[model samples]
Target chain A: MRGVVTLHADGLSKDFGERSALRDVSFEVSEGERVAVIGPNGAGKTTLLSLLAGLQRATAGTVSRPPEEIGWVPQQAALYRRLSIRENLRLFARLERVADPDAAVDRALELTGLADRAKDELSTLSGGNQQRVNIAIGLLADPPVLLLDEPSSSLDPRQRAVLWDFIDGLAAGGTAVIFATHEIDEAQRHADRILVLGDGELIFTGTAAELHAAGGDDDLVVAFVRVLEAQGH
Target chain B: MRWLLLKDLQILRRSPLLIGLLVVYPVVISLLIGFALSRGPDKPKIAFVNEVPELQQTINVGGDQIDIASYSDRLFERVDPVPAATREEALQMVEDGEVLGALIIPEDAGRKLQTAVALGGSAEKPTVEVLYDASGPLQGQLVESLVDSTLAEANVAIGERITEVSAGYLNILLDGGSFSLLGQDFDILGLAEAERILGRQAAQLPAGSTERAELERIRRFAELAVENLDFSDEILSSISNPIDVKETPVGSSGGTTLESFAVSASVVFSLMFVCVLLAAGMLALEREEHAYGRLVRGLVSRGKLLAEKVLLAALCALPVGLVMLVVVALLADLDWGRAPLWTVGVLATGLAFGALGVAIGAVAREVRAASLLAFGLSLPIAFLALVPAGTVADPLYEVIRVVSAAFPFKPSLLAMDAALNETGDMWPSVLHLLGLTAAYGVLARVALRRFG
Candidate 1:
């Protein structure tokens, strides 16, 4: 179902004073493509997503679409814990300037499979359910491109499976999903393309099998490590 | 108890903000208030309507000429005088709050006083009017007392002058007389008898004689002069109390002192504390819960987001303010003067202080910090704003006035006073509140960008 490119970052660079957080980072994500940005700490994974979302100003770069057209989900819950799940969705939906907020909230709840607990406050929900509400807010505007920073870093195995399944549904519906993660296996299994970052630079961009051949290792984790080590990360 | 105390200490140690609120805030407020009290209070200006400035003439007093017309003008050192052109202008100044009270000296007052002093007596006494708003009893009484003291001093000076003139005339009369009785020279009756014989002789021969006509004029002059001296006792008594000082209450306050205080205190203090806490706590909670970032990233602009929070705070404070007013009205039987205007004043006060609270929240890093900062400052702000003009040193009061003017505290209080008391105009306060709201709103946005 992948089609024309829906997201493009060209020569993106972000600098905090003299130290660079992200430099010359470039990538293209097509509709329905799941791109995983894999990097160690301080490798600018979050910075890259923030730059693409226009929440931050890049030192030098350009994004193809306007910032409003892209959905951004940060690492934290970043929600009102006292409010119910449906209330949270409706508030964000209204912020997104959706034509019909109630309809948008309903769709987000159904898409996240959280309709049964829609009335439950986020503070009372389990970790996985809270994460579902987080993603639900990002999906409120139905942006063609979704950027999540570590979507499943804190979830259990079953919760992680539920999250990836939900993401797969979005991708299948022609929404390009970009996620930053430390899990190499997750990147290999779920990503249509893997972007390896080393010291604020893009070191590799290829499929899991192609990365395995280049890294001279069968295991995806070894390949990811080798890819980073080759660039002296 | 020791273990519990230790546990409480451990909890307190974790909150620097609470410690600051309990320790530093009080010390700072105390110092400020102590400093203000150390300086003497400034006097409010009283308007003076001198209608006889042109009749500035000197009269003889105890062998020395005194400028009687300028005596009252020189006696107003205790209270600053704002010279008004007319009685109407002076009263208007009081109504407009330009001056706390007005003193109106009626037309030809100087001429009348001069003539009375020259003739040594008069049938009519000139009166000056003192006008003040009855609703502001404290200020009104203060102004009235100052005017009374000044007029009393003027009366003493005039009485001394009159006594000196009478003494001078008594010496002249005794020197001119030759008769003596009971060890005191007495000649007024003998002189009157001689003048009566001269007038009788002159009348018999005054058909066509120039000498007889001259004798008649001399006799008439002597007779009138003796009669004027005979009335000296009455003149001396009247000179001691010449000017009539009348106190006129401009606007009536049907309530007691406690009722007036209830209206002003409830509006100013309640709105200030409530609106500030509500707005600051709201933003602090949002930041503490990690939702502020998400909110900023949404489609709403930073200004609009701040506006929404500030508006919510103000709206919430409005009911609290109204409830306090209603409760006080029920308990104290107070007249809320112009309900619609008072409501507007309350709402304006809320909006202004709510914006200030939002600014405080934006600068603070956590909920506790914001709460402490808002609560810690509200009481002092209210106190300084309501510290009745003359209660602090002139320089300190000037600084306080400037600070309160820049903010919405004093203006809102004054506006509410106008609305509730119907003593002056309320539009100025509303205008100031709106202006301050905009300024604080902008400050909140800037702080959010820097610290939020």
Candidate 2:
């Protein structure tokens, strides 16, 4: 999305006991880049995002980025139901060692369009509002790399649009974003480049037009299915 | 009505654990405790003060009198005789938290036995004084039983001595002392003739018991006791119960029964509410919500995580506890034996219970498990952790007490109990609470490492 890459990964692999979650996946994200890690149910999308966010250590290979430069939203929204939105933001900012937590919290609340509901507890908000609060917490200290694993999995179509538009603004503002999604069309439409993983391996990584041409189809979704079939899925 | 009932069922299914906590827990806990108490008496460690050790002698009792040093030595090991040279020193030991309950043996106790045996039933009855620490209806019973048995054997020895005195004069009485008031041998004398004979003997009988029937009567009275020879019913009553058993619990309060109960309820309930709400409810919720993971990702250290939990728990729990104490103090003439020290104990209770809750959360990783584990542990603690310290002075209880002793509130509550009862050494309780709080904090830290 912008010049000069700020994050780099090479041949990242992870295994949980005997089961391999990710293997030989390499990627690079420049400032303002939006990279979508798209895969099916056990394609290691969440695991790859976790490794990128430094929420986990890779079993082999490496991913390089400043630890403080990354923010993560787990599959589950990491917001305490009892604490107010403002309190949650302030807590995260304080914990993240932000230079001025008060200012950071206020700014995050305003940016997320949750300034009106900042004093309200997360439990009292609508599902979409709660997701916004979760995103605000991740963006509170202004980390450059935002890793969200299936943030819209629970959102409806309208809520998903709201979330993607907000995420789009972050990428436009020069924050590199990596989000995992099972919806192929959404990923094809939103991301600058798609990383398609099949059976824990990165089978393909390219733009929707490049993927369509490679699979010999005009429809990107059909092309994605063709690529997975070719990868022995 | 049907819809309302259906709604209740839905709510119940939604939070089945909450319902179980409110209902099943109490019933199960009551059953466990009832079974344990019914099994047998939990013996206490009674501290006997050997104030006059030289004078405490083993009386020769029964046919096999090869002899033990004293009945004290033959007692259950729980009853330990602490060597206290003086009665004052023994009581001071109790106040200083050195010993539990104690029995004082006088210097002339052994001499009284010797005199009883030599004079046969005509000697002075030796007395024993018992001293008990703070509160223990149970330990008091144990001490009473011990003394009862010891004195019982002594009574047997005195009875044998009296029988020997009776036999010494039985040779003369064997002739049946046939009496005739009118200068004739009347074996079947009427009341008039018997009265006349008694009057004759009374005039001629030297100071006491010269005749055979008179000697027999003396022996009967001597079997009970001999020194105070006034044979009226009132005199016999005094002799029968010689040991007054004046159990003066060092600092007994001069308050209503309700007031005393309020203090105990204050300490125990304060401990329970703070610990359960913080550790089990809040901490487990944090873990379940993945906030702990989120916090760590935000560069929060492990120590800060525990500190935050403790701080939050205290913030929530201490005010309620302090308010409860203030209300009680205002309602009654609550004797804060050592006022500043009592306040310190209350504070320690809050801190320690907060740690206890954290430790529970560390062990139990989910909301249900945390609640069950914390409450399950706390209920037993409230019951077994006797506040007066010596309330359950059984040596056996002491062994398992190590578990409850590790809780800060246990020691803090004990100090409060002791101080209120007017029997305590403040440093011991405070130091114990501090040690346990640190231990609990360390345990929580270790537990969170694996649990997280």
Residue A199, model 1: lDDT of 83
- Single out the weakest 10-residue window by summed lDDT for candidate 1 chain A: A1-10
The interface RMSD values of the models, given in order, are 1.7, 1.6
What TM-scores result for chain A when each predicted structure is judged separately against the true chain A? 0.97, 0.96
Model 2: per-residue lDDT, tens digit, B1-452?
A: 99999999899777755567667878876765565566434444455655444424544322223232434554444455566767888788766555655667676665665555445435685666777553443334445566567555544444544344343333223323444334565454333334445556556666655474674454444333322322333422223322223455543432213345448556656766675557656778878887776776547766777767776766665566666666777886666555666566666666677778888887776887787777676866676655334433344345436756766645665666555544446567767766766777888899887666
Q: Which ranges of candidate 2 are over 4 A from the true structure? A: A97-106, B1-125, B131-240, B246-269, B315-317, B331-337, B387-399, B415-432
Report the C-alpha lDDT of model 1 over B255-311, residue by residue, as the tens digit.
Answer: 225446557766788788788888898888888877776677647677987898789
What are the DockQ scores of the candidates, in order? 0.38, 0.39
Q: Per-residue lDDT for B62 in model 2?
A: 21
Among incorrect, acceptable, medium and high, the docking class of model 2 is acceptable
Which regions of candidate 1 are displaced past 4 Å?
A213-216, B1-31, B37-258, B329-337
**lDDT of the candidates, in the order given:** 0.80, 0.68
